[model samples]
Target: MWRCALPPLPRYPTVDELGARAAALVARHPRDARLRRVGTSRAGTPLWLLSVGHGSRQALVVAGPHANEPVGGATVLRLAERALADPRLCEGADATWNLLLCLDPDGARRNEAWLSGPYTLGNYFRHFFRPGFLEQPEWLPEGADGATLPETRALLDLQDELRPFLQCSLHGVDVGGAFLELTRELPGIAQRVARTANRLGIPRELGPYDTLYWPTLGPAVYRIPPPRRGDLAAAITEAAVESTWFHPHPYGTVTAVVEAPMWGVAAVEDPTPPADADAALRTVSHTLRDDTRLLEEILARVRPLLGCSPDVARLLAPVDDYLLVGPGLADSWDPDLRQGGTRPLPPLTVARLTALRLAGRRVALRTAGLLHQLVTASGHDPRGVLPELDRLIDEWCADYRDGCGARWIPVARQVEYQARVVLAVFDLAERDARVRSRSGETGWGSPAAVPMHRE
Candidate 1:
C-alpha cells in the first residue's frame, strides 16, 4: 500500500492559491510535469490542465467538478506532487495522468469565502454558492441552447482530446458518511476502496445515499445508472445528465466519482434498525416538505423586490429548482404504507439522513442571503423580507449544526482516503487491463467479467 503522508492543510486553498500551487508543481518538475491553458472560465479565469508523466494509457482526473466540492482540488495537487516526486507511480500503470485543476472556477470563486474555513455549518452556508444543476458544468445536457457553460466545454474538449480509459471526478458532501460511485462495476476495486476507508476510520455512507436510485455493489459503493434521454423522473426533478455518460472515447471511459463528507458524526454509519422505522422515514419526508415550504414562502415575498444581478440570478437558480421540484422530491420519500414487507431504515440512519437533508436546506436558503446582499448592493435598505430571510438562515444553520452533531473532518484525512482509493482503482485498472491483454480481449472492460468483491 502506498501511504500518503499528506501534511495537514490548515485551510482549503483559495482559487488563486489553487492556481499558483498547480503552477508551482509543474515548475518543480519541468521535465515530467507540464501545465497547459485548456479553456477560459465564464469569469475569464484561465482553466489549467496539468499533465504528469508520458505513459501511453491516459487517465483523466477532474477536480472541482462542482464548485462547492473543493476538497478534490487539494487531492489533485497532492496526487500530482506524488507522481512528479516518483515517476514509478505513473510508470507502473503505464499511464499519463491528466489533472484538470478547478474545473468550475467561476462558481469556485463564489465559494472561496468559506473555502478556507472555520469549517462550520454557519460559515459554510453564510458564504455558500452553488449554481443550479443545469448550470453545473458536469451535468449540462448536450447542446442545450444557451445552457452549456464554458467550463463544461473545456471538460468536453479535454475528454475528446485525451480519449482517456479512466476518468475520476473528485466530489464531496457537506455532512454525511463517505461513499463511492462508479460508472460500471469494475472488478476488485470497490472492496479494496471500502476496506481502506474503514481502516482510515472514515465510516462508509450507509444512508441518505446520493446515488440512492443506482444499483448497489456493496456498502457505500454504487454503480451509476445509465442516463436515459428525457427520463420522466429526472425531468420532474429537473436533474441534468451526468458528465460520465458523455465520454467520446471509442474504448469506453470508466468514470469513478469519490464522495467524502466535510462533516462527520456517528449516526451516519449506525446500522441498528430504528424502533419505528416507518415513522422515522415519515419524519424525513415531513422535515424536507416543511423546509421546502419555508423557502418557497420566503422566495415568494422577495420575488417582487428582486433585481437582475447576475450573482443573485446564479444563487437563485437552484432555489427555483428546489421550489419547483422539491415537493415531488420530498413526496418521493414517503414510504408506501400499503406495501407490507418493505424494509425500514435504522433510527440513527434516519436521523443522519434527515440532518443531511437539513444541510441541503441550509444551502438552499443561501439564495435568500444573496437576495439580501443584492438589494443592499444597490444601496437600498434590505428591510421588507430580508429580516425574515436572515432569521431562517440562522435558524436552519443552527438546526443542522446542533441537530446533526456535525464535526469537521480534517483536510489531511480527507486527502489521505481519497488518494489511497484513487491509486487502488488505478492499480485495479492496470491489473484488469493486463488480464484482458493476456486473453486477447480489447476495447472496454466488460462489467460482467468479475464481481466487485468476492462473495
Candidate 2:
C-alpha cells in the first residue's frame, strides 16, 4: 500500500475503456505522464505503455497478461495515477514506473461483458475467455508462430529494452482464494505481502491447486522455479514460458505474480478433509478419467458434424487438439496429485478441481459458440449444435452454482488484494538492493520446500 490515503478502487474497465484511459492520462498529465505505442494487438488495437517518474532504476508492471484477468488493469491504472501524483511513490524507492496497462486487448475485449459489476461465480464463468495455456501472450514463443501475435512481440521488445530490476505480471484466477507465484523467495517479501493481505481481509489460499505442479514458498505463495528439462512435457512447462522476461536476469529480478480468485473457500486453507484419504484420491482420479473420456466423446460428436465446412472445421480444431492432449496429461498425474497426498481431501479442493473442469467446459462451449457464429454468418447451421451447446452450458452452470453456493470475492476487493501484494514485492526488492550494496550477498531466508503437509 502507498503511504497515503488512497482513492476508492476504480470500476473494472472494459478493454477499450482501459486503453482510452491510458491514452487520456497523457493528455491529462503532460508533464508527469507520457504514453507510447508499444505495438498493435492481433486485432490491430494499439498496445500502449504509460510511464510515470524518471528515476535511475526501472520497475515494470504488466497487467491483464491473460484476457480474462482484467483486475490487473485496475492495479496498473491505480499505480500509474499514484506515481504521477506523488513522485515520492517511487522517489525513495529508486525506480521509474512502466505500466503495460492491458497486454491482450483483443482477447480482453471478448470478456468485456463481465468486465464491470455483477462479479459473481455464475456471471464470471458465463463470460470467461482465457486463451489456451500454451497460447498465452506472457509465454508465447519468439519463433514465427509466437511472432504472429503482435502483443507478444511488444512485451518481448519492452523487456529486452528495459531489463527491469523488478517485474510484476498481474494475473487472476476464479477460485480457492488469493495466491502468488514468484521467481524466488525474496527476503521480507512474504511477510510484507501477508500483512497487506491480512489488512485487506484477503484469505491466503494455502495451495492445493496451483502448487500441485509447482514449488511453493509459504501459505498462498508459490514459486515458479526454473523448469528442469525432463520435469514434464516441454510443451506444458517449457514452451509455455519461452519468452517470460522475468527470468535469466544477470542479477535475479524480483518478479511476482498475484493470482487473486473471484471466490474464496475457507476450507482451502484448512489441512483436514471430510472423506477418507485414499477414498478421496481414488474418487478424484476416477472422475478425471471419466471426464477425459467424456470430453473425447464430445469431440467425436463435434468433428464429423462439421465435415464439409472448412471454416467451421478451423474453429473446432483447438477443441479437437486439446481433447487429444488433455486426456494424457490428466492420466499422468499420480493419485496424490489428482487429490491430496495420502491425506483426505477437503471439499474446497474438490471445488477447485470443479472450477477447473468448469473452465474447460466453458472453453469448449466457446469453440462451439464460435462455430455457431461462423455458421450463422454464412446463413446456415450445418452442425445444428447451437441449441444443444446452449443446453449443455446451462446445465453445467447450474450444477456449479449448486455445488459452490455464495462463495465469491467481489471485484473491488480482488483488485485491492492483488495491488497490495504487488506493492509489498516492490518494497522487498528495494530492501534486497540495499542489502546487496552493503553485505554483497542475497539472503531471502527462505528454505528449500519439503512439503510438510499435502497441498
Candidate with top TM-score is: 1
TM-score of each: 0.87, 0.80
Candidate 2 residue spans exceeding 4 A from truth: 1-11, 117-123, 140-148, 229-234, 237-241, 245-248, 304-318, 333-388, 439-455
- Give the residue spans of candidate 1 off by over 4 A: 1-8, 143-147, 231-242, 245-249, 336-383, 440-455
Error of 2 at 450 (Å): 33
TM-score, structure 2 vs. true: 0.80
Indicate the residue-level lDDT of 22 in model 1. Answer: 76
Tell me the lDDT of model 2 at 334: 35
lDDT of 2 by residue, 1-455 (tens): 45423344445788777777777777877877788888888779888898887776677899988887788987887777778766555676656889998888877886787777686645565566656554567764444244556777788677656656678889876555677777767766667667876777666666444455565577667777653333224454233344464432433456777787766655455544345444544454555555556545655655554455654544455455455544544443335454444433234454345433444444344444444344444564555655655565566555445643426666678777887787777777767756764674432211111111211
For candidate 1, write residues 1-455 as lDDT tens digits.
43334454667777788788878777767888898999999889999888999887778899888888898888888888777667567886677889988888888898887787778776676677777767778774654233467887788777766766678889887777787877767777768877887887776676544555556677677787655566533642423353544453234567788887787655766666567656765766777678778767766766666776776677777667656655655565567542445433333454345544644464355655555555555565444665666787787667666876667778878877887777777776666666665786543333333333322
**RMSD per prediction, one decimal?**
5.2, 6.8
